[model samples]
Target: MQTKTRRSMIIIAIANGLLLFGYGLSLPFFTIYLISQRGLTSSMAGLVIALAGLSRCVSSGISGELADVFGRKTVMVWGLFSQIVAMFALGLCIELKVQVGWMLACYFLTTFLGAFFRPASNAWVTDNTTPKERVEAFGIIRIGLNIGWALGPAAGGFLVRYSYSMAFFFTALLYAVTILYLNRQVQDNHTPCKSRKPSFVSALLSLKDSRLAKICFYVVVITAVNSQLVVGLSIHCKQYLHMPEYYIGWFFTINGLVVVFLQYWATRLMAKIRLSTAMFIGCALYAVGFGSVGFFDGFTLIALGVFLAGLGELIVSPGEQTLVSNIASRETRGRYLGMLMVFYNLGSAAGFFGAGLLSDYVAPHYLPGPWLIVGAAALLAGWGFWRMRRSLTDEEDGKTNVPVPIKKDTITLN
Candidate 1:
């Protein structure tokens, strides 16, 4: 039984990994492609990315609620099917020589569809696993995520060098493969919630509960800091440091290799540390890593900074996700994860736009502006973690001193 379960998890991880890899392959290059091929300004490219993230903020929440009303598998299937269409649309955009505005519209639609999969995927794992198993399960998923991210860009860069259309074609093929893998290999029989659909506004309102609100806030801040890697770091490397385009893939590859080797061990180590402390330490590392960018010009030093940032990311991401999972009730798992994902998307969108504006006008020095912002964001997140550390500890101990569960229906505070 354990073997079968493990096999199922691995299959799901591969499907998820492929989907993410396809996205990562395109993400770093999308803006550059738009600027070169479509005559878009840097600000316009940033806006396009921000719009996709904005769509995710809306779509993830709705998908989370829908996953609760329908089954997780049902929602996941919908997401994957939509991804196929999105990839095809993207490819078509390239073929038709679509305008930049139209391309941005497609990108928004694609991301909106894609966002639905994440909450469903997260909730499905929680639905399947026991508490003791969840941390390790999440770690496995994270490994798959990193592996996909690591491979995607390197593959995409090589494909783009041959033909930009080939990049989209490859992405579409991966999406098709992902759909087939999920359809053939996976089985999810969890029942959907029978309750009436919850309003997104009401869900957002529920976050007013001090403890839950605080946790969400910290997640937002941390995600904002992390966004600099995707939006700012690549641009910084290319513009100021005169790094070659191909090296962007190598940077992520190095980070992915580190995470693949270290994440399992890190997950085990996290068993000994408080989740909040781990998050705090992770944010601090981000601060140091991003801050160090201002002082370093060598590719080696910059790569080292990225490696340290990845290390911090490895520590915080799984721990923070596990912490969120532990805090919510089973019935509301989708909604909680969805809400968390929204915060993540919002932070990322804000960071991208903010970084773009700063790099364009405020600090033509490009590298320093985004790095400083990321550092400041990390410090702010750390402070939020410290303030809530006591509450996190109390809640873990089953102490009543912590705030009550925001919803009356929640079974345990965790």
Candidate 2:
């Protein structure tokens, strides 16, 4: 049974990798497309992304509760199938040169539907792995995720010179293929919680657990900081640094490579330290990486910045995930993760909008301004995590240090 579960874990990781690959191939180009093709201002584009993120946070948070009652596979299929349609429609919007409003509508749908599969799939992973094993397990998943990240942009860089729409079409194709494999090969490994059904708002109640709430807040801040890479980097390089699209793609590919190679080792290292300590360290690295970008010029320095951020990612991300897994009982795992993702999306929204504001208003007067702001935020989040160390614990060691997580859960709406 252990072996089978392990195999399923790998399979799920592969499917997830395919999804990330599609995203890397196409989604990274979204801001660029919106600006260059559709002619939206930087602030306007950022606003669009922020709103889309709002949609994602709500959908994903709600989807988690849905996953708890419905089977993981059921929710996964629903989200996956729907996302494919949205992707194709998005592609058509791009290909046909549709109105900006239509394009925005499709993109919003795609982002919102994208949230559905994640919590369910992640819950499936939690179901299969022991709390002790979750860091390494999530590390494996991250590896799969970054492999696509590594390759997708390099391929996308080349493909975009020809057609941005093609990248979208390719993304949809990859997702379709993943769905086929899922139906044929994968089983619903997670059994649903039988106790009571839940509503979308129920996941928000989990925030009442102060420790869990802290973790979710950290995710928001970090994810926002990380958004500089996704939402701001392209604009920064193209507009300020004067780097071409392909080079930017290459740099992102390298960043993903860093995560892929180092993630497992980082997870192992994180297991030795308190999860909060690891996150604090990771955030410090993020500050150093992203903050330094503002003070320098040229590809080499920027690449260095991206590399440091990647190092931060490989370290904290798995440990952070393990924390959530450790905090939730098995029955509530899906909802717990779902709630975490809500913050993740919210962070993305904050990042997107914040980056745009910095870029539009600040970058013109001070080239390093946007990146410096990003750097400062990263450091602040690191400090926050360090202080929260007492509230968290190490799962595998079976030790309770401080901030013993409250045993009482918030009531879920029926």
Candidate 3:
């Protein structure tokens, strides 16, 4: 059973990797494509991207509810199916010279469908793994995610030079492959809750648990800080620092390399450290890295800062995820993860919108605004983690320290 579960995880990771790779390939070029090829303004492009995230925010909660009522596997398969359609629609939109507004609509649909899959995927992992293994499992998944992210953009950039349509076509092909892979390899793990259906109202009511609520809040803040990489740092590089376009891919590559090589060791090290303490350290490093951005003149120095930020990301992310999984009820695990993702999407949208507005109005001073906000947000989150550290230690000692079969058969939802 353990071997089968592990094999399933590997296959899921690969499928997820391909899907993310397709998305990553398009991400760096999407705005550029809008601006250069489509002759749209930067704000318009930002709006389109923001709409995608907004769709995720709205759909995630719904997806979680669906996962609980139906089955995680069913929701996941459906989500992947939607992604395949979305990728194809995106390609068709570009190939047919669709209007920018229509193209944005296609992007929105894609993200909305894609958002439904995450909670199901997360809950599937939680269902299959014991508490001790959850962090490591998530870390392994992150490796696949980052690896795809690392390679996708560079490939996208090369492909874009030939034809913009190729980028979307590539995304479509990869997602189609992902759908087939997932359909064949992944198994359904979703058992219905005691109730026949789980509603959004019930999910909202579950937030009465202060610890759980706080974790979700922190997840939002952390995700907001992450937006620094996509929106904040992008502006900083392009506007303030006047860096070349190719370096954007290089920055992601550096981030992926760090995660690929160091994530396992980092997770092990974090096991020795308190999860809250690890989060605090991660946030501090993130702050320092973002804060130093204004001061760095060379690509090497900036890369160093980006790498340091990635290190901080590595430390906090898995630990935070583990902490959430440890505290959440088994029956509502998908809902919990989905709630966290809602916060994540909210944070991401706000960061991009806020940064876009700040950069637009603030002019030359705009570059620092987003980073400073992110740095401040990280510090605030770190402080919140520090306050919660004692509770975490007590909980870890009492509940999470125990070891069990990697695939614990306790179905809390049932």
lDDT of each: 0.74, 0.84, 0.74
Model 1 per-residue lDDT tens digits across residues 115-159: 888888888887776555566677788888888878887777676
Error of 3 at 85 (Å): 1.3
Cα-based TM-score, every candidate? 0.91, 0.95, 0.90
Give the per-residue lDDT digits (tens) of candidate 2, residues 75-184: 88889899999999999999999988998999999999999988888888887777666777888888888898999998998888899999999999999998997898
User: In model 3, where do residues sit more than 4 Å from their true spots?
Assistant: 1-6, 39-44, 240-242, 366-369, 396-400, 403-414
Model 3: lDDT to the true structure = 0.74
Clashes of 2: 0
Candidate 1 — worst ten consecutive residues by lDDT sum?
395-404
The model with the greater lDDT, 2 or 3, is 2
Q: Quick one: ranking by TM-score, best first?
A: 2, 1, 3
User: 1-414 in candidate 3: lDDT tens per residue?
Assistant: 267666766776787678778877776677667766887655666666676787888788888878878888888888877777877788788878888778878877877887887788888888888776777788877777778877887677677777777788788788778778787788876576656566787667657767768877887787777776776666667666776657876887787778878988987877676678778988898888776765676899888888888888887777776776777766677777877777778877766666566556653664455567668888888888767765654454223456532223222332
Please report, as a residue range, the 10-residue window in candidate 3 with the lowest summed lDDT.
Answer: 405-414
Candidate whose TM-score is highest: 2
Roughly what TM-score does model 2 have, to 2 decimal places?
Answer: 0.95
Worst-scoring 10-residue span by lDDT in model 2: 396-405
Better of 1 and 2 by TM-score: 2
